[model samples]
Target: MEIEIATIGGFEEVGRQMTAVRAGEDVVVFDMGLNLSQVLIHDNVETEQMHSLDLIDMGAIPDDRVMSDLEGDVQAIVPTHGHLDHIGAISKLAHRYNAPVVATPYTIELVKQQVKGENKFSVDNDLVKMDAGGTMSIGPQCELEFVNVSHSVIDAINPVLHTPEGSVVYGLDKRIDHNPVIGDPIDMERFREIGREDNGVLCYIEDCTNAGHKGRTPSESVARTHLKDTLQSIEDYDGGIVATTFSSHIARVKSLVEFAEEIGRKPVLLGRSMEKYSGTAERLDFVEFPGDLGMYGHRKSVDRTFKRIMKEGKEKFLPVVTGHQGEPRAMLTRMARGETPFELDDGDKVIFSARVIPEPTNEGQRYQAERLLKMQGARIYDEIHVSGHLREEGHYQMLDALQPQHVIPGHQDLQGFAPYVDLAESQGYAVGRDLHVTRNGNMITLVE
Candidate 1:
């Protein structure tokens, strides 16, 4: 049996996450994602209003070139989670290989809503929902299993692909959050079980997003404290209280809702992306916000909802909207630019429960939004947020737990993965042998 793996994208970069795994004639592709930086840099596409196909057409993201190269040999395409950086490209390219797109239920629903909003009909790829601990057969030569893990989002997992030669474990973009608000914690027992199996893991692809940080990622519970403290610090205001955060951050939203409840106000959701992602989470039983909360999933609906809320007295409701990165078309930016009917009143609170995404386009847009918010006499709260990725000590712990024959870093550049390389060296794993540093489009083979 011949085992071959290639980084279609997202090897030495932060986004456009795709990887092809093949053994004998059966092949499986993981995470056909879009590069947010590439899209913004090349075509000036904003994340909130991004259309996947447009990025593909402009050469801003990868097409189906990787799967197409395998001809009809591809058996399945899987996304480990629902984050845009992991599953954004599935709708644009999953049909090319005519393979099943397997994932947890929430991830599938989120992808479908994203595709539908783009006015694109669903593709032919079958979406099969697999439970966290269940296994599914991709073909005669490959079996796929989802091992539950914790991250910022619900239903996140590390996929273990059992092939003819050996197993390949994909551990990209995860954290070991023990006190997650939405779901259960990481199943370390199952992970150790896989690590100790006879065939074991021939290769392990791990996330290097926080390789530079020196410790385990702080829990979502810590972020909840920050958000709650920020909200409590604000003085009593009679006007609207608006917040902007990552649309997929259901935990943050839950915390905000709890704060709103404590402040004797109803929570209203604005912006299409925010409502869509939140709806998927709710449907999967991930969060349990109050039923009285109102949500607007369309631009026109959001505008009308804001007008009604203003007319009825804004203090009665706490609005959580989009534009965390200041995408111009999102609700917050439109409000800031006076394109929407809603106006920020004096003493009103506009909280940004996220960080600036450190990209040129995002920097410019965020700057514009802040200026406009100040001009409108709104009190702005910024950086009341925390990261979702693991840090250096966390990486060390994961490496120690799932001791594999080889490690390949994902979702980072060479400079970003340097700390991980050092950690591996200290653990007696040398470069080019047990530690594999590869770039995008490079293929590596595992031999027994």
Candidate 2:
């Protein structure tokens, strides 16, 4: 039996995540995503008029040319979660293969919404829903399994491929959170069981975005505590209370809603992505918000809603908007610029339930947004959040739990992956041997 892998993108940089794994002759693709920085750079370009190839050339989407040779051998395209960084390119690239696009229900719902209003391209294959812990046989020699994992997004999973040679697990974006607010914690028991399989795991490919950090990542529960503390400290303020974060973060959204109710403020969700993910969460029964909560998706509706908030006094409403990364067109950035009817007074509070993504593009965008908010006398409370990636100690624990034969560190550049390499080496794996180090477009082959 033979297995080969390709890291198409999201290897040296942080986005456009695509990976092709082939067991025997059957091939499976994971995470067709977008490069946020590149997408932001071409912000004014109309995607509907651009060909997929042009976007690929512009670095907006993953270049699938690495798998050109296996064009007809592809079996499936699977996205681990609903984040655009994991599923954005599906509508643009899933048409390249006749394979089904399989993912959890929430992810499927989000993808359907993404491709709904566009005539640029359509999904040529069926959208199959496989909940966590479900398994599907891809071919006579290979099977796919979804192991539940916790991350910023709900219903995220670690996809594992079982082949005649051994099982290869793709855990690119997850953290071990025992107290995730909306979903069950990391399925460590399943991980340990896979580790003890007779064949064991052939290779464990994992995310190393936080390998340099020490200790485990704080749980969503901890972030809820911090948010509560911050909000309580500023509860007596006489102006608007606006909170912004990743719209796909259902756990954080739920926490914010609960906090809003606790402080006697009506919860009003504003922005497109906010309504998208929150609606999915409600439909899937992943979270339950108050029935009377106000939500708006379209621009006109958001404008009308904010206008009413301004009329009724901003202190009476807890408004949640997009642009946590300070994206130029996000709702929060527009509000900072007085594009919305709502205004931020000198003592008004703006809670950022997120940390800066740390990429240069994100850093610059955030600086400008904060500068604008400060100039308006808005009290900025940033970084009142917990990361959704496993820290160094958590990485060590995951390695210990899933004692795979070989380790492949991904989702980071060389500097970010170094700590993961050291951790795997400490566990007796050898670099360039059992512990493989690779970059985008590079293929690694293993045979048994």
Candidate 3:
């Protein structure tokens, strides 16, 4: 059986991650994602109403036209997680392929929500729910397995395709988190077992987002502790305190909610995304929030909640909102601009429990948001968080564990792939031999 891999999208950048593995006549695609920064760069771009070709033209979503060249039946469209970068394109593009979208429960629920919000395309693809450590047959010659992994979001997994030639590991975005806050740790034992199997790992396609960073990526528990310490220090501040983070980060939100209660503040979930993600997590039994906790998504409801917070004393409530990256329309940005009912008084505290994404667009927008908040006498607490991507030392450990015959650096651009390339070379993987540094819409034949 022949094996071929397609570097569809996200090979050149950190977002819009899509990759396909063809094991003989059966093909499985991983992560039909979106480059959110591309869409955000444009003013008032409503992707929900946009067409797939238009999104592709704008480079916001994967240009999957290259899929025609790969001759195989798509057995599954598997999204590794629920992050927009991993599953945002599903509603737009999955209708084109006659395959089910398989993912963990949380990711499947998020995908369902994303599909319902679509206006241009009617994505009726079956949403299959599979848990971590589950296995399913693909075609007749292959099996698909999900290895539980730890990341910024809950219920993330690295999908593996087992074939006659060997095992193809679709290792996109994850960190080596042994002590997580919400989910199980990264399954290194499973990875080592796969590495020592009879066929071993044929190829390892990795996320190189933080490959340039020197040490290992810290655990989500570290960020949880950091957030607790920050909130506790301001326990006695009689002014308002607002917090923001990735809406998909259920673990972080849980921590914020717990610590807010500990510090004598009622934590309220504000913003559309904050309500959508957290409410979904709570509804799905992935998280358990206090019965009195409030989640307000609509503008009117959020404004009403803010008014109540004002009436009840701002010092008694902690509002966790969206816009950690300073999105123009997110709740935090609205608060910073004074467009919302909540007013920032002198010495008011605003905590960003997330890092600014390294894109120029996000950095500029975040800087502007911070400036506006500071102008209103808001004190900013930034970067009380740890990254979700593996760093240099983690890459060395992965290579040692998997020992794949082919290594492809992904989730980064040419400049970002440089550090990982040098690191792979040190491990005796040569360029064009075993280690491949590629771009979008390219194909590499591993066996024929």
lDDT of 3: 0.95
Q: For residues 1-448, what per-residue lDDT tens digits would candidate 1 score against the true structure?
A: 7787877777767777888888777888888887765665554445445555567665445655545454238877889888877887776667567688888888888777656654343576778888899898867767899999887777888899987656899997788788877788888888888877768888889888888887688788888998888877763677788888999889899899889888777888888888888877877777877887787888888888888888888888888999988786788998888888787877688999988865567888899889998898988889887777888888887777778888888888888889889988898888888788898777787762
The superposed Cα distance between candidate 1 and the true structure at residue 218, in angstroms, equals: 0.9
Whole-model lDDT per candidate: 0.80, 0.88, 0.95
Stretches of candidate 2 above 4 Å error?
none
- Poorest 10 consecutive residues by lDDT, candidate 1: 63-72
lDDT of 2 at 210: 93
Q: Point to the candidate with the largest lDDT.
A: 3
lDDT of 3 at 20: 94
Cα deviation at 88, candidate 3, in Å, is 0.5
List TM-scores for all candidates, in order: 0.92, 0.98, 0.99
Residue-level lDDT for 428 in candidate 3 = 98
Candidate RMSDs in Å, in order, are 2.7, 1.3, 0.7
- Pairs of residues at least 3 apart in sequence or in different chains that clash in candidate 3: none
The TM-score of predicted model 3 comes to 0.99
As for lDDT, the candidate ahead, 1 or 2, is 2
Which should have the higher TM-score, number 2 or number 3?
3
